[model samples]
Target: MYFIGELKGSSPDLKISLYKWNSKFFVKFETPDLEQVYKISEMDVSEDEIREMVNEEFIEKIITRFKEMYQDLGELMGDY
Candidate 1:
């Protein structure tokens, strides 16, 4: 895999890694215990465009979910 780009300081506490393998693009998001991968292909659109869209939308949703999960864990542990 070749490094494409990274979105850092764009989200709260997470960083997104973008990679390319041949004709496919990979979006990776990692935390302490979880790693998420999203694949993009050149179907009707260029891979570059898809990568941009994933950065704007998919990564946002993943960060939101991570925040929600962290909050839930804190509440469960009575850290409120």
Candidate 2:
């Protein structure tokens, strides 16, 4: 994978990286203890569109999902 660049809207605590490998584009979002990744076909969307897609609302949703993931993991670990 080739490292492209990070999202401008990403916060210091949350790093978002963009990568391109073969015919697919990979977007990776990482927090201190958790991460989320998504793949997109290069033919499906342009690089510029990816930037547009990751707006404030999108970032909010990602944050919400990260919270949910942390909660779920905590609960799972508690059970263990």
Candidate 3:
């Protein structure tokens, strides 16, 4: 149930990590400097008591977004 959020701000130097446990999804956002961390409360979801509620599309989208964010950060750091 992990899902990545849309990118915000300029420079594309932000990083986001997402993971699913049981039926809940958690997300954490960090800056390129790794000195700042923010939790996105808007995209939280719970899978309580739902065993088969997981969807493939949802997981795919999350991984895609994470990759894009990572690439954007790499570009900003001249590692692309």
Candidate 4:
């Protein structure tokens, strides 16, 4: 129910967390590659709300973005 940090690589690495409370879900984003963690954002929503809002097209778009970002990161890290 959360869209934590996006994965951008051959394997997706997520820097996000999800929490549930009272049948509602919350997502939290964390800083990448640090000894200490910092929150970037948070959102609360219900399962039905998510199912209604997020569809296949939206998910595909996200996957594309992650792939692009992952490739870019790999290049930067000289690991590709």
Candidate 5:
């Protein structure tokens, strides 16, 4: 995987990174213990376009999903 760069302006608790691998671009968002990766075809979207695509609104949705995922994990762990 090739590291492109880190995205800015989202929640500080979340770390966002861009990468290229296997002819696909990987958009990775991470918290302390959890992460989410989104894949995009290089043929479909250029690198510059990716910056535009992963805007505030997109980050907001990811943040929301992360919250839901964390909640689900907590429930499954059962008082741990």
Candidate 6:
């Protein structure tokens, strides 16, 4: 089975999609021009629990990674 939903209260510039299938959860974070996906197990945890905890945690991580990536890109361009 498959299920999908949007993360409520997320930033307009950062849209988050949540999906569940095959006893696993898949989360996608997207902006106008960029996207990232994260997969995690559903083992032992209820879907509600995942929604409450994992979703926000993953989004925070994705945002942090994007920030770091952009910072590094700027530094690399500065070397030129």
Q: For residue 43, give model 4's deviation from the true position in Å.
A: 9.3
Stretch of 10 with least lDDT, candidate 2: 7-16
lDDT of 5 by residue, 9-42 (tens): 4467999999999999999999998999999999
On the 0 to 100 scale, the lDDT of residue 80 in model 1 is 47
Instruction: Give the distance in Å from residue 67's predicted Cα in candidate 3 to where it truly belongs.
Output: 1.2
Better of 4 and 5 by lDDT: 5
Residue-wise C-alpha lDDT for candidate 2, range 1-80, written one tens digit per residue: 99999986778889988899998888889999999998999999988888788888988899999999999999999998
- Model 5's alpha-carbon lDDT is 0.92
lDDT of 4 by residue, 9-80 (tens): 212333434445445455333334321122322255444454444445654555566567667778988963
Q: Residue by residue across 1-21, what tens digits does model 3's lDDT show?
A: 555443322135544455454
> Candidate 2, which segments miss by more than 4 Å at Cα?
none
lDDT of each candidate versus the true structure: 0.71, 0.90, 0.45, 0.43, 0.92, 0.75
Looking at model 2, residue 78 earns an lDDT score of: 100
Give RMSD (Å) of candidate 4 vs. truth. Answer: 8.6
- lDDT (10s digit) by residue, model 1, range 1-80: 99878854345456678788867778788787556787876454575676557645666688788788777778988954
TM-score, per-candidate, Cα-based = 0.58, 0.94, 0.36, 0.43, 0.92, 0.65
- Measured by TM-score, how close is model 2 to the native structure? 0.94
Clashes of 3: 1
Ranking by lDDT: 5, 2, 6, 1, 3, 4
Residue runs of model 5 more than 4 Å from their true location after superposition = none
Give per-residue lDDT, candidate 6, residue 53: 69
> Which candidate has the top score in lDDT?
5
Task: Judging by lDDT, tell me the better candidate of 1 and 4.
Answer: 1
lDDT of 3: 0.45
Model 1 worst lDDT run, 10 consecutive residues = 7-16
